[model samples]
Target: MSKPDKTSRHGERRRFSPSMLRRGMNLYPPFLGMGLRVKEFSDDWTVCRVELKLTRFNRNQQGTAFGGSIGAMSDAFHALLLMHQLGTDYHVWDKAAEIEYVSPGIGTVYGRFEVSPEMAEAIRAEAAGGDKVLPWFETELTRADGTVVARVRRQLYVRKKKSVTERERADFTG
Candidate 1:
């Protein structure tokens, strides 16, 4: 269950119930691929706890996980969080993403994104008007050794697609 957005500055401290996100897999692909478990997320931040599945890895010559897989895990967190917090009636896509290697990525990888209420507000403001892309967000990927494997910045497009009310997002109390 997601908590109500206490700080209204992030547009409106709205909570996109986790159960709702779970039922909407058709809306996201990476979430399906990443198979992430959202530990926690508010309007401003998110923490996703995921294990690096061997099946999803490309063993390098040295047996370390593939850099692309590492990057993908990190990048996917931001997209998942955005959808969970912001609700539907908008479109989101990875505008751009970048990753920096820090370790050998020897073990399970975890991804986290701090969205900040201020940033969320900004995204709402930008998308509230139209379908223009919001500014990019930076998230981090960490290895089991507590080393930063990659830092990713993803640009997103959020727009009010056809005046979505509470029901469209299934937020209606009735």
Candidate 2:
């Protein structure tokens, strides 16, 4: 598959492959410390799977996964997935999140984040006029046996960047 159509702030093309992102995420200090691993990323950047293994560093008094670790494991993935899908022409950020813990993650918990083509297109269309669009996404944290451990809901803020001319006009008016 081809690389995503991403650009830097200077408008130059940038190469940020899914594999690179996965490697970086895995190496990140917080994630690494908590035994979190980005196990897989689809070539299209729409799907990401993360796993949190039970370890001393991430275990709580109950000998299960720490709540913070569970929350962190499911955080930012939706925004990251959407950012790559929307490219650099737009801004994407995590606006809010809520997690409902259904069960203690005894051994290992898995979470999958996905932003379908239709969802991406809808966000793009909604924000095409330079207005901000807030979209909510939901997923489940499950165990290897397919038992649900937690439910995660995330909201993202997306907006199209203003054209150079528009920025100049706003600057002059101000």
Candidate 3:
């Protein structure tokens, strides 16, 4: 599979560098309000680590992490990673999500997301035919000590852009 052109589904060039994305995510209203901070975002957009600190703003009545906040930790990342990897020719979006609370999140918890080259290749192959593909991914929210706090499952919708498909058809027929 070829590397993506770093354009959005709207065909605009992606302007944010990895650091910029990390900073932007940290300041993003919902994340900021929920005490979520992106600790690491790799230059290749393949690996991202986010930390959720238990604070008054995101604490439940039981004094643990808010369920909404925990769910938020899994939002947008899989789609973002796959979009960047698949480039302008494809559209990627979060189609569905589910979070299973394993334990009360106390103190600080972390969520890590990774998109391997093999995974990207598989997705590209699956979406090459211009049909939408829904792929599921899973990650864990863990405590500082690596105890599981929650399990998050995300499904992303990916499809080749119609323009790309049309252009390819023209190339073949013309």
Candidate 4:
């Protein structure tokens, strides 16, 4: 028996590729039970597309996609993207989230989450000095024909870890 390597080929902690992330998410119970599938993840980790299909298991009693399923589909992507982008040196968490039910979802509904380069850069810069930064991201769940069924907003808290030297410097400056 051999121990599994936790580091990537580059000697850094193994970073989850889009495919890997999708596969792992599919196995998660909440998503699995709801038929939420990760349809796509961009190579750069900037974009993620998720879809939920209406079925007996996931449909509401009124015969539409369940609100809980829609909300679950909206969760996690923003934080996941930021965590990978920021790497091991930073802490990223989903501080808050809100979802608005705009209309009933029918058939297959899609949700896409994207973080622009500018937004990523802004988060990095804001957290570089060891201060917490809150960044908000929004996405919509839509039907196959592009009718929005819901809107979701997520706010993330991010902060860079301070090294001993940086901590000492801050202490002296204070």
- Better candidate by lDDT, 1 or 4: 4
> For candidate 4, lDDT tens digit of each residue in 18-68?
688789988988888898999887766688899998888998889999898
**TM-score of predicted structure 3:** 0.86
lDDT per model, in order? 0.59, 0.88, 0.87, 0.85
In model 2, the worst 10-residue window by lDDT is: 3-12
Number of the predicted model whose lDDT against the real structure is largest: 2
- Higher-TM-score candidate among 1 and 2? 2
Residue pairs with backbone atoms closer than 3 Å in model 2 (clashes): none
**Which regions of candidate 2 deviate over 4 angstroms?**
1-14
TM-score sort, best first:
2, 3, 4, 1
Q: What order do you get sorting by lDDT, best first?
A: 2, 3, 4, 1
TM-score of each: 0.64, 0.91, 0.86, 0.85
How large is the C-alpha RMSD of every model relative to the true structure? 7.7, 3.1, 5.7, 4.9
lDDT of 2 by residue, 2-118 (tens): 755466333546467678889998899988899999998777768999999999999999899998999898788889888877777889999999999999998999999999978
Q: Tell me model 4's lDDT, rounded to 2 decimals.
A: 0.85
Q: Candidate 1, clashing residue pairs?
A: 44-115, 44-116
**Looking at model 1, which ten-residue stretch has the lowest summed lDDT?**
35-44
Candidate 2: C-alpha lDDT: 0.88
